[model samples]
Target: MVLIGICKYSGGGMQLTKNPNSTDGLLDISYIKDLTLLTILNNIQSLFNGKITSHKLISTYKTSTLKINVLDNNKSYIQADGELIGSGDFLVSILPKAINFIIP
Candidate 1:
C-alpha cells in the first residue's frame, strides 16, 4: 500500500508527518529550519521514535492550510512528488478524509 498525502516541500527535503492516520481534518506539518547534521544526530533517537517535535529547534503545526512566500530571490522552488511545480509563493490545503487510498 502506498500512503499518499500532502507534505511540506521545503529546501531541505520532503518529510512525512509524525503520525499518519489523518483523522483530525488537519495536516501535521513538521520542519527544522536552519537545520544541521549535528542537531539531527543529537535528536536521532527522538526522530526515530516519532518524537521529532521534542527538539526545541523543531517547529510543528496542525493546520488545514499553509501559505508561504519567499521575499528573497534565492531561486527557491516548490516541488511535488519529486518535481518542481512552482516557485516564490505557494499554498497547501488539506481535504481531510477526502483523499482515499488503496491499502494493498
Candidate 2:
C-alpha cells in the first residue's frame, strides 16, 4: 500500500502523510531550531510504538531522502518517496554518491 498525503482529521490528533514524495526534503528547522537529533528521534518514537517499521535512506551528491515504510498486517507492502531539498554534509559523506529506494 502506498501512503500519500496526510490523513484528514476533523478534530484533534496529528495528520501524517503517507506519500513518500510529498515532502520537499526541507528540514524546516525554523520551527524547532533548538531541537536535537536525539530529541527529535525520541519524540518520533513515542508517537507510535511498534507502528513504524523500516526507514530507507537515499543519498545523492548533496541531498538525502528518507523513505519511511509503515508496517500493516492488513496490507502487502508500504512505500513512500522524497526528493532532494539542499546540499548537506551528510550527503557528501555517504558512499555510492547517488541513491534510490527500491522495494521488492
Candidate 1 local distance difference test against the native? 0.59
lDDT of 2 at 80: 25
Please identify model 2 stretches exceeding 4 Å from their true place. 1-30, 49-81, 86-104
**Best-fitting candidate, scored by TM-score:** 1
Per-residue C-alpha lDDT of model 2 across residues 1-104, encoded as one tens digit per residue: 22233122211332232223313432211012244577548666532432222222211111233343335444333232344343222211223324353434
C-alpha lDDT of candidate 2 relative to the true structure? 0.30
Quote the lDDT for 96 in model 1: 62
**Span of 10 residues, lowest total lDDT, candidate 1:** 1-10
**Poorest stretch of ten by lDDT in candidate 2:** 53-62
**TM-score list, all predictions:** 0.63, 0.21
Question: Model 1: what TM-score?
Answer: 0.63
RMSDs, each prediction?
Answer: 6.0, 15.6
